[model samples]
Target: MINQSELENSKEVGIITDISDKELHLALGLSDPTCNNEISQQDQNESTHDTSNSTAPSEPQLFFQAVGLVRGQYLPSTEKLGSGILLLDDGVIAPTNLLASAVYTVKKHPNLLESPQVWIVYPRVQVKNPPFLNFAIRGARLPLEGEDAEVINQSVDDFSIRGIVTYTNRKAGNFVIKVYRNFMPWKEQEGTKYKPHIFTITGVLPSEGLPCGQFWDLKVKRVADQLVLEDATFITQVFEPKKPKKGRSKRQGQKRKAKRNQSNPQ
Candidate 1:
């Protein structure tokens, strides 16, 4: 039951699964995401039948049924601090810390909302202090400094939910959204993925209800002076909410500051 205008043009996260021994481990919320991958790696990352057709064209991006509408959604009003955590599956927490590693390279961004912000390195495994509930990405160009996104489960709706403001720090909290290019995701076969966006927030948790977003536009590389991100930290942003410029109408700056305070009255 999601379509509040496509979860407000989406960034809506929903998908839940947590087997254990057999290693299903892929939660989002409400459960429903289990692919054996036909014995694993979807059969060693399948797809290899070009029949001398010279298959090496590559280069063709654009897709998004729901990578959160190329990752763009906001609600703000939880408390803050990038408050998003949920990750409960451990055989030592491998599969790139939580990516569950099966072989992924999604590239959806042809126009409609643009999904695929870049900056991928799945695998953190520190599970002793900070779990994971800080899923972020908005026009992410890559190079995510400090890195985040852990929680596998604790019932934060299931996992990866959004609608923040829990105090401040969804990477400085507040809001940011962009990248609404529109539609993209092409893969006839290779795990059979065309577009599988799962989202359903009934009571907010896997990040507080709804906000599976991503769409950034940042450029920082200061290094010593600080500020950096070009390859690791879930880099992505596109939260546009800056429109406050309509002054001079308050009786023209109070009648030119009362005619310069009557020509200077100290």
Candidate 2:
């Protein structure tokens, strides 16, 4: 739901280092190449850039879109003054300077966390040696209501998410969903026996709307990173306890009363 207008102002654009058919097929769950003929045709037409002469081959650059839950703004310790921390989608706790701007933006606008459906735009450049993906948030914003979904979908190069909705501001037109690393098992003291050890890729939708407690399954896709509402479903609902109001605890009140009685000696 990122507004089209905002994308123009975005500073960082994503890059696709590798778009091989096999990779695309695995990522998008496409059974036939004909389904994504546009991407395949484009790939076939473009000649591979030779990197031996240059520092690195210039790859296709596009905006990468992802829905992330803003766990919270990280405040670095005194020793690491400028460094910042960001808990991104899939429980990946990133404590680095790369997300410094994103962290500052979130801190400046605390409201972003309220509707934690944060739209992250970054370059998806793959590092050669370590085989790690290095991403930097170029821009981010809360999705607007009645925004053009088609425009947002077309701009991004890739999109993948699996998480639970932490917050929802339907009036503002967005909801927060969190993602977890794959193969991470679900841990619970009581429900361990019933649920599977690892999370399921697909889930069932019991009701309508992206409720706060619902666990979403957003994996299946014909085109890489193009999300379809019909394909998105919910696995189950999670009921979280309401946070207690800030104040003195019952134990503290009792201790205060005891201190008063001791001083008064009535």
Candidate 3:
């Protein structure tokens, strides 16, 4: 008979004597001695793994990273609106919609809007109903005017924008434009296709009506809670032209004639 120590340490015969129930289960290709225990342990491991891998939901973003130039403010008893242009990092200039709290804070510290500064904004969305998004400023700070800022600011002062009129709210007398501007001359690469930088511009509608899908060059100024359109010049109408029906090919025509002759036999 084999010695007890030799049986416990046996390798060739695969005997695992004097081992714990957990080790015995492992040796027998079982996760645990009992099915319930195995399931419970697997569930626990999955729970732990899921908990470790899960992440908290992030807040919505209203604007990309950029510097804001505060141009107008409205402080009323019930509401506040800070209107300005956002100098985006991608060299696009767009309008802003500030929240009441942000407007109040900026009102208290008027200097925050005196010059170009980086603004942090948070987006609020409603669970039910339209116009659910709300953009609120969290804070602002003066930028160092580094190379990036300088490059973005180069086209900020004077530049032409071409955009489509995306939205028009008649009752609200406000509209939104999707503007596209070219990058700085130096930033453009040779031998590569050119792509314009794009951003959205929210402004008040001018006295003249602006139908949707019509392109226009608008003169806007910061006012109240949005940019007010001072004037507008029509550019061109954009629409999907109806495609003409394709004619039948010569082989298809012949096949159709053959089918017709077979059907009528005349």
For this target, which candidate reaches the highest TM-score against the unseen true structure?
3
lDDT of 1 at 146: 66
Q: Which RMSD does model 1 reach against the true structure?
A: 21.4
Best-matching candidate per lDDT: 3
TM-score for each prediction? 0.18, 0.25, 0.26
lDDT of 3 by residue, 112-212 (tens): 65555555543222324433332345555334556465553432222233444544545434554543221122233444443322223354444354355
Error of 1 at 90 (Å): 26
Relative to the true structure, how large is the alpha-carbon lDDT of every model?
0.25, 0.38, 0.41
Instruction: Give me the displacement of residue 161 in model 3, in angstroms.
Output: 5.7
**What global local distance difference test value does model 3 have?**
0.41
lDDT of 1: 0.25
Residue 5 in candidate 3, Cα distance off native in Å: 85
lDDT of 1 by residue, 224-248 (tens): 1112322211222212222223334
TM-score of 1: 0.18
